[model samples]
Target: MSIIAVVTALALSIIPTGDTPTVSVQQGAVQGVQAEGVAAFKGIPYAAPPVGPLRWRPPQPVQPWSETRAADHVGAICIQPPANGDNAVGPGPMSEDCLTLNVFAPEGATEPLPVMFWVHGGGYVNGSGTADLYDGSNLARHGVVVVTINYRLGRHGFFDHPALAAERPAEEPAGNYGVMDMIAALKWVHANIGRFGGDASDVTIFGESAGGVAVSQLMLAPDARGLFAKAIIQSGVPQGATSRLDIATPSGPPLADRGASFAALKGVPADGTAEALRAIPAEAFLDPAPNFGGGDLVIADGRIVPTSIEDGFARGLQAPVPLIIGTNSNEFPWARADTHPMAQALTPEERTALIAAYDDADDFQGRFISDVMFNGPARWLARQHAARGHPVYLYSFDAWPDAMPQPHRGAWHAQERQYVFDTLSTSPWPTTARDEAVAKVASDYWATFARTGVPAAAGQPAWPALAEGHEEALVFHNDGVAVEAVPNAARLDLIAALLDRLKAAGLR
Candidate 1:
């Protein structure tokens, strides 16, 4: 068959059949499949495919389709580094045309339910919303609509070159294209989620790791104002601010300089035009990819990411929305307690007191790094947000998998994801009765928070909001849950002091 005929046939096959759930979004009508009391619409295009000349540009409006497009299976994920042995890969093959989102809502619900928009984490280099671990059926059944999105990743998602900027000429912000994709997705949800039985006004943006960082970014972006009502940051950074767009930061060179350096490595001429840069194959950018281990994933482009997350919150410029933020107890169990840049700012007495506070020398490094990097920052952000008169709830995740047996020191990074999504069945480690129980409690807390402003779970302890005098968090462990004062206050205080010193010295 000819190319046009083949395309027509495939499009016709996707037309809604009898009993298939259909919803009319602004772009067009879509047919979704229903199972287990949930209506799942997959591979829904929210923005135009970023390909060829459109590459590196802000997401454009999705072209309207005349026929009802099939929303049964997932679309291709954005081009990213291969996972090798990692299991966090998304559902489809990798491609540049991957700006779609997935929606899961309770089937046949009359009233509009709360909307929970999720952003996946992969160090800003990998990951997609279509990962099995993010299956939203269970969470949707809890009386909420769940939406997960795929943004630009790696160079395809974030890049800044003087030539590229000149082409746009003060149009959209340069760099931070992935973040722009996110805001476009949000605008789509705000406009069309109601047709899917979701309350657009009650949307909550939640994410893990880099995704959590994005939640904070959206809270700071001026274009994202009033897009969401609540925010949750799971394992997000509170101190490590991102690099500036045109200006150098303590972290590294400005994004424009980095982009030029990358272009030089790619053999682009000093006076190369934007067309020459765009002509380079996408795969070429991956062979000698920019160091993925460090922090250049997103940039503080003045238009999109107006300021660093820490600076935004510090300046009280972030949206005064309800917040839930926390980190895992043992985010890095293998980190050795050794010299650090921040440690250089500590005095001998202060360093001794900090070490003595953690108690166990064998696990000193793990606990210390966790406190300074994750726990302490989480508490600090919580305090800042709470001080703004907005409701804030904090928590610590300390549960271990059965595979990692006792004297458990590993709540390791991102371990709470399975529990928060109630996706223990998809866990790589063998789960026990306690694991399932913890998943229920953890997922309940999250879904409950999305449903209402406060988090509450049946048969579990009430989660308290952070206040001036009383600061407590809902601690999730293997056995059960508890609400206690934020753990290791002295250690966190020392970490904070050291970090403040580092910032003062222009090293952070």
Candidate 2:
């Protein structure tokens, strides 16, 4: 047997399993199984399926069922391309009827506990909450309730056709249907989480990558106000001017134009209605066209994401809540990575000036990408939260798994997940005692943050709130977790200056 299987079996052997646990939600009673001291309720429908006539529309209420429903297994994931090596949580069979969520709570809990609603990341294209990497059992064992949810993905989730817009009610805005599905799940939690021993008023929405972007978006979404009390953004930042709601410059086409282009590719005429596009098989939209390159599908629609996220933060319109945000040490390899707007705009002289401080030319690109895309944005958000007088804790994950053959691999994107969820055994990498130690610390920090606004535990280092001059963050390493000043601040500052120069030149 695999090490993970052996570990899982050993873990399961300790907890006695017997009588199934049942909880009555708003729709009906759900029967779940209890194992390892946690009650797991899976495949609970939070919204009606967006299929057939309801395609591309805002989520509707689920029909109630009188008989007890069995929420023992996960529902179908959203439509997307099959998973590959790049996407560890490979795609499974998908269906339109996939708007479901899972809840994990401490068994025999006398009162409602804090809720951590997780959003998985897949670049707004793929991923499901049911990914094995996101098992909440270990986290739930810490006495907090955990929730994982699935929303629409790719074109099916974020499409905006002019004909469709015209067909919808005047009051309901179009596009960002995936975001709408998240809001629906949150609303359901607010109404029914108490039944699962979760405190609705103490919801903490957390996510990684695209999931992090969703959390940031939720902070700006007016409809999402009051749904969550705390937020954790991992390796995600807000889209700047490129995603403004009202702007439709050549560089950033309006939603209707984007829809028209996509429909044209699908052989639908320019004047074709939304129904024509919806009638096409869902699979037709899953695969990217040969050499197809496009802008973000998760754009700001007037109703869901009212304004540019940057504008919202500048105007202090974001939901004022305690936040913990950070990124990995090495987000991605920067070699020939000319895709970033900053990278594309940088002159040779500007590039030379930016790289002068770094000794290793080989690693410069990776570090630059990490700083510009993930670390810099995270710090900017931390500063914003601090300036607004909200509690904010920043972090940098630098721990490398000993199981990997490469010795110098810094914490790459999504690596912190195994530690944060205390599921190191399930990871493909061969874990060590140091990994377990880090996992305990990271998971405790997360659980503590969910319980209270502060991300502190009895034995771990005391994480301080971000403020002027004291711009410190907790660095997670294999050796230990410690509070230290932000690393590579000078290099990041240089990159930020170049980006400012690009903005002044009107490149964006």
Which candidate number has the best lDDT? Answer: 1
Model 1: CA > 4 A from native: 1-19, 240-242, 292-294, 405-409, 505-507
lDDT of 1 by residue, 198-245 (tens): 777788999998898889888998999988889999998763336677
Model 1 C-alpha RMSD to native: 6.2
Clash count for each candidate, listed in order shown: 1, 1
**Local distance difference test scores for all models:** 0.83, 0.80
Question: Model 1: which residue pairs collide?
Answer: 337-365
Candidate 2 wrong stretches, greater than 4 Å: 1-18, 85-91, 244-252, 290-295, 334-339, 405-408
Query: What TM-score goes with each of the models?
Result: 0.93, 0.92
Model 1 is weakest, by summed lDDT over 10 consecutive residues, at 8-17
